[model samples]
Target: MKKISILALMMVFGVVANADTLENVKKQGFMKCGVSTGLTGFAEMGADKKWTGLDVDTCRAVAAAVFGDINKVKIVPLTAKERFTALQSGEIDMLARNTTWTQSRDTSLGVNFAGVNYYDGQGFLVSKKSGIKGAKELDGASVCITAGTTTEMNLADYFKTNNMKYKPISYDTADQVQKGFEAGRCDLITSDASQLYSLRTKMKDPSAYFVLPEIISKEPLGPVVRQGDDVWFNIVKWSLNALVTAEEFGVTQKNVDSLAKSSKNPEIRRLLGVEGKMGENLKLDAKWAYNIIKQIGNYGESFERNVGKGSLLKIGRGVNALWSKGGILYSPPFR
Candidate 1:
């Protein structure tokens, strides 16, 4: 009886120890990443059947860190309603779908937010013809919102706090909300300011819609991972951190190769895996971060290429800039 009990205990410990997600990813030969259905400049499929955007780059960075090849990821597009459920159910390895980090979501859901990739805020988008300059003007106006998202509660709170009332026309996806707004189903649409800009560009006349200046609630959007896998969580978290750190050190894709071999800066050396066990600590190859910088790019490069001045969004760095540049973006030391 004692031998049987000891054998059973050993079996349990074996199962627990073998639950490393990184090992599973390697065995499968590819990483599964969840993205939005089709949010322009965040995650969208182009005419060439390729996914390109800020969120897509996040996925590629993780892939490069693990496989040394960015293309070893399969993009799984998910709606806001389906995203968390998919992660919880193990349908994807990680979620880089521009999801917000909130208290209730962080604690209640069986998932963890890696870190804030985009510091955003909720706002309203109205047509120029409405002659409305602010969100407070629409007391009784019908508002279009995406269902099963934080926007629903934000809209309710904003109206109630101001002693106002409005009709809510909720939809399943951002595209549906955009279609409803364009079809005159609602007087205005409310979403993340960046999303509003993306949606406006899809309109017949992008200049006709104007986003309100009032940013209602704080929405620090980032990637997510399952709850039990601390190893995988650390890998994803630091992969994002590497991007910001690389940019802070001026290590772009164009110069990462030379820097890896010749740069003498302590932080840069640790980051590029030239003088430390940073990669080994994360159970990755020594050239993990070097691969990410060489293949995908640093954070600023991804932002500029996908949604900043280099893209149609033309969004200023604003609060997304580095901490040294008067923004909140700061990475922990590689040491």
Candidate 2:
């Protein structure tokens, strides 16, 4: 009788230990997501209160994977300073904000960048009327920049190496930086070039501003999750991988269902949740990727909808294009 009781207790502990993120998320009924406060094309709340943008869509894809409904997510809008704190405090399960993946952030911040969803570089935006054609022209110019970001350090280093002197009017948020730049407090606004493009589009006289031709630093922005939870980390990482893999496999939102039923490609079938035990291995239902593709589309689709050809941002897919297409976008094999 004593032996049987011990065995039963051990069995229950084993089951609990093996329970993964999918099970916890389903039990919770909603995936908590950290998003940007309002970056326009990256992560913003719509008029109808629905969250939309590349970062928002990444969260929606994770929700779709777990719940089969993209709407089963709670978006917590976080400022640059608050993003990591919210993730650390468990206020959000995952962060899909426009966060730069850096070595210190990965090692010291107790979070892991799942993958680089957007390849960006830091650059400057100046009024064309100022006759500043490139970053080198900004010598002795006052620059508006955001605090608590790698952009600050990059800006400092770039100007120092060029032997230029400039005053940095650093604000705690991007909105404040934009306002300072617009109010003539600073001669130039510096950030990721993609962000500069988005901010320029929002300016009253967008034609007045021109993004400088120099990209100063590499910015591989992506979703992040708390470290030490391998199950949760893998879910976020592989969900991103699924989107990239889907795009690489020629699987779009429109054709996923048909391809799931009839495509002869083994990889496509596996990615679409048609064959193989991929979903089960991830501790999710077999229709996980199918739901994600059907609901959120692929990475290319999200990029086009939020920032590329379809949106007002109208940024070209330069380094964001697929590896086969001469860009750096590549995903690990799904198998």
- Which candidate achieves the best lDDT against the true structure? 1
Model 2 C-alpha lDDT per residue in residues 1-335, reported as the tens digit of each score:
44544423543565322234456667789988998788878887789988889999899988988888999999999878888877765678899988899999999776889998899999999998898887777889998987778888999999999999999898876778888899999999999988898888778899999888899999999999876678778888888999999999989999998898899998888887778998988888888888999998999999999999899898888989999998999999977
In model 2, the runs with Cα more than 4 Å from the true position are 1-23
lDDT of 1 by residue, 1-335 (tens): 44554423543565323247799899999999999999999999999999999999999999999999999999999989999877766678999997999999999776899998899999999998999998879899999998888999999999999999999999988889999999999999999999999999888899999999999999999999987789899999999999999999999999999998899899999999998899999999989999999998899999999999899999888999999999999999889
Instruction: Work out the TM-score per prediction.
Output: 0.94, 0.92
Clashes of each: 0, 0
Which portions of model 1 show Cα errors greater than 4 Å? 1-18
Q: Model 1 Cα displacement at 67 (Å)?
A: 0.3
Clashing pairs in 2: none
Residue 181 displacement in candidate 1 (angstroms): 0.6
